[model samples]
Target: MTPSLHPTPATHLPLTINDSIVLQSMLGVGAYGSVYKATDSHTGQTYAVKCLSKTGLDSRQRAFQTHESTLHSLVSGHPNVATLHKIVEEDDCLYMVLDCGVEGDLFYTITERGGFVGNDVAIKSIFGQIASAVLHCHSKGVFHRDLKPENIIMFGQSVKLVDFGLATTEQVSSDFGCGSTFYLSPECQGGYVEMVKSYDSAANDVWSLGVILINLVFGRNPWKQACPRDETFSAYILNNDFLQTILPMSTELNEIIKSVFCLNPRKRIPLSDLAKRVQACKQFTTPEFSASFASSSNASAATATIGQSGVAGGTCFVSSAQREDKDQGDSGVDVRSRA
Candidate 1:
């Protein structure tokens, strides 16, 4: 009755590989690095993976990475700011995995949609969200050197300030010129290299924010209209003529923008007071504007089901639940991603 017994082999789970997190397609590329849409194998979550090449790992790049690491360490649990999940290194490349925004950058959204959101109440509500995030950054002593629309992401009702690659600490006196030229403060662009040594990064960030607000309202740079040439643009900003052009916006909104973009860094509006000034604006109290703002806020949530992959070669999926929601209203609004 004794029969031959067979030994069983144990099964092991497959190890996760780098390639498994495929580069669906390039989201965007710049001098610093390129970002990609990658799927995490372990959790099947989508992430925006920013990779810094070996050749691009200069002193500036290293310094940026260090500052970003510090910021992430300090504000680890903040919901309004983008969360850094992991930093993966493969040979010479450094990959930063971050929470992917389903709705993508706010700049792209505004640029693609040809509509002016001039309702003051709507502007105030959106501005509050942005200011809250920026104030949090200042409280942490981290100044975002580059705070343009391209760096701000919108997910549902929340807006996160991303691209800390150009961000710096309070003690950092001077580093390489990093920010976009269009958003740079006067002192930052002054001819004297030594002048930047005295440049206050915090105030500079405020100026950039003002420029962003102006762009949001006008959909174009205030200075861009005056000086089409690069040299003229530099001259215009240095002479403070750019301030005059921005004054055409409402008196309250104009004052807020001016306070932030003051040529004298010491006179610039501190992040602590931004929320109060934004609330004081007349635009924040109108019922019609409030309704419009609420609708725009919902627009981001509505587009959440849009595919993370670009329009090149991926299969876009829209669930039945999402379809039903889309059919409820505003089905005519174009949800195309920017090139």
Candidate 2:
């Protein structure tokens, strides 16, 4: 995991923007800018405004910002995505007016609960919305290269996908190492070592979704990176059911993961089918996730991360639940525009 994923509290923001917009608080923080909770004084309406400063952006960065806005426009119509109402540009910065959510994100919620298991109803409702949003993007030829708990804001069980900075219109990209380590697909981690020509961006999105499923049930990543150097991933490569040892996974859930986590991207399950499988899944966790083994699960979540620190990026990914004391924002997921 990159150190940048840890969202820090923004200490200062303009008192107001343009003329009637009053910036209330920080929603999310990212590489190029930070999202703020703002209001329209004239209309007395609320919005989550994503602010991007032009001060430090170079030619490439400026182009990347434009590209992100374009792709986000293509898929923002979806019900599960955060709506980008309009773009307002000033001499100093760019502001994106978006849907306002008073409730916080899934990352903050999961981090607080230490992974809520045996609640298939809430999991299904949340993951189902996420699947619909991803499928909507793929249908429009836009790929959300970044998909994780951090990028999703929750309204109880419902979710909205955010942070299109890493999005792309390309069907394939040779731009290896574009996302965070834990959620990256094997083909995406193709740095100089693999010399990978290109990989299917759509398939790459599916792999990230698979990791997210593991996170929903287990409250931890299945492995750090999909690379062979990682011990847990290597064990899973040799024996498909290795994840069962770390977490109480059911056979049905295992089947779905196997299909999604297939080594061959071409052989990976289609998004439409995958969504149905997820909706049909009866149990993602065994009886162990109940009160009886709650303490045991917590102990194991800590140990698994220690034993299998991921190789890429030279950082270990601990569960968001165990990583911090409290989350500081109600909305915003900031993924760096690595691609």
Candidate 3:
């Protein structure tokens, strides 16, 4: 007979779940749940098990959890995307077994290394894999609304994208301001003179990817938010050379950013083409900027090389590079439908 799983109210964790699953120490906690580092009893395999408490989650929140589970299961096999092995449901909570990223996340990696300023090879490898994962998701009829560095996890040299709580199958959404502030497109941010009744979620994903590319190269965000209110983004809208003028980026890199962040959804570069161009680009920044970044001992000093890009102050950002996936719902909209 299979052993029953029982939880202690204090930790809300069970010693074992059925025949194979064994819960270990707690990894982190989200709005309604906690993630644990667990192991398979029989095979001795490690996993990241997320436990969502049914304590006070309403029907809608539970549906969102189902939505997250269903979408993640659908895209589990992709190498660059984190794998969802199985989900176990009990009377008190829900548990999802997923791949554990041991080394850390891309954000931590970049912050630890100071940045990827002169590392074209690592950029191509990491960014290319991320683009490939997005393409696979698009092919599967799912759109990953959130694609920031914080959502990406690393296992040694390999990386996998995670946190699909906000994903949707639909191409367009009326849910304005749905994603992270820094990574959102102008249309997604929604306060333009032209009334945007709805916006393309896919295009918005591409725009987020662009911001992540910049983060990998510069170790800082282009702007706190992508709306007219943010002076940095406002300047970019008025002047085509705004990004180039503020930072010492190469022509190839500048053009790519311009294309990726284009105001029109229809004009945004396709993921496939963007993937190719990323590898083809000769350099990401000028030698002077690269040298300065190399000389700077800390990330803050390295980011200061850009005259007014706003890197020193954490005042503008809602999330940091060190932020964990446990705070998933707090970072983005989790609009979900009943399963």
Candidate 4:
């Protein structure tokens, strides 16, 4: 028989979901909640379960949580984004079982593996995966407002973008002052003062991608801020030839970077076009970045064999990387429909 899951009111942790699942240890705390490394007691399969308490969540916080769950579930099957195994909702908390990223986040990986100076291949492969993920998100009308290294978790040669606390749909009313400071686009910088006009989330993501690519190649950001007022940014704005001296990169790469870093959002390459350009760039296929990612298909098959189902009358399985299920909700019905 399936056992009842008990809630720890004091520590706010679920004691155990059933006879099949056991909470092992705390992973880390997020902006909204805590994550735990858990194991399937029956098959010994491991997963990460993020826990968010409903105790004191204000309406705004509740809304964000709902939105995150909605977006995360919608984008779960993408290879470049973390997969959601299943979501277990209790009266006091929401348990999100996600794919485990054992290698840690991108920031730590870069710091430990030595900067990308001679490892151009890793740079291209990693950036390509990220671009693909962003393109997929854009196609679904979901925008990941935050795109910093810390939010990108690495699994050896592969990566999975996480932390959708700041994500929003295209039709939603967006607020100003979102995302990290260093990765902000020119429009994002401008949007702070011009509160009346909302920034394009997709374009802002492209600009941040430019910053990320530059950091991966050069080992540091070119400027502290992307606004025209910033001295370094202003210099680049005035001199079209400045990147050549600073990057020592091929003309094709330089052109791609310039297109992404264009101050005018309208002029920046769309994610669809950027994906093609980046893929076509000969630099991506260079010997250094040719390493292959661990197969998610294999992982999914393993998970399906061991992951538990029939938990409190809910189903469970590792989301397939090739899933083509579309979100059919036209409004606020997303979370309930998916769950």
- TM-score for each prediction? 0.68, 0.83, 0.86, 0.74
Residue-level lDDT of model 3, residues 1-339, one tens digit each, is: 000133233254556885778887665554555667777989998888777777678898788888888999999899998898999988777888888877666766776655565677888888999999999998898888878776787766677888786789988888876656667788876744466878887888999999999887777677777776677777788986677876778888999999998888889998888999999998888878777766877655665555354434321322343353122434321111101
Q: For each of the candidates, give the backbone clash count.
A: 2, 1, 0, 2
- How high is the lDDT of residue 107 in model 4? 57
| Cα RMSD to the true fold for all candidates | 14.5, 5.8, 6.3, 14.2
lDDT of each: 0.55, 0.72, 0.73, 0.63
| Predicted model with the maximum TM-score | 3
Q: Give Cα distance to truth, residue 151, candidate 1, Å.
A: 0.3
Total backbone collisions, model 3:
0
**Candidate 4 C-alpha lDDT tens digits along 1-339:** 000133232253445875566766666654456666677888887777777778887888777777888998888789998888888887777778777777766655544444454355677788899998888888888888777666777776898887676788863335655666557776665542343366788888888888777666544455666665566666678885465554445677788888988867779888777767766777522232222212323322322322221122122111221011211110111010000
What is candidate 3's local distance difference test score?
0.73
How high a TM-score does candidate 2 get? 0.83
* Model 4 stretches astray by more than 4 angstroms: 1-14, 171-173, 192-196, 283-339
Give the poorly placed runs of model 2, Cα more than 4 Å off.
1-14, 191-195, 287-318, 321-339
Q: What is the per-residue lDDT of model 2 for residues 19-66, given as tens digits with 9 covering 90 to 100?
A: 888777665565567777888899987888777777777888778777
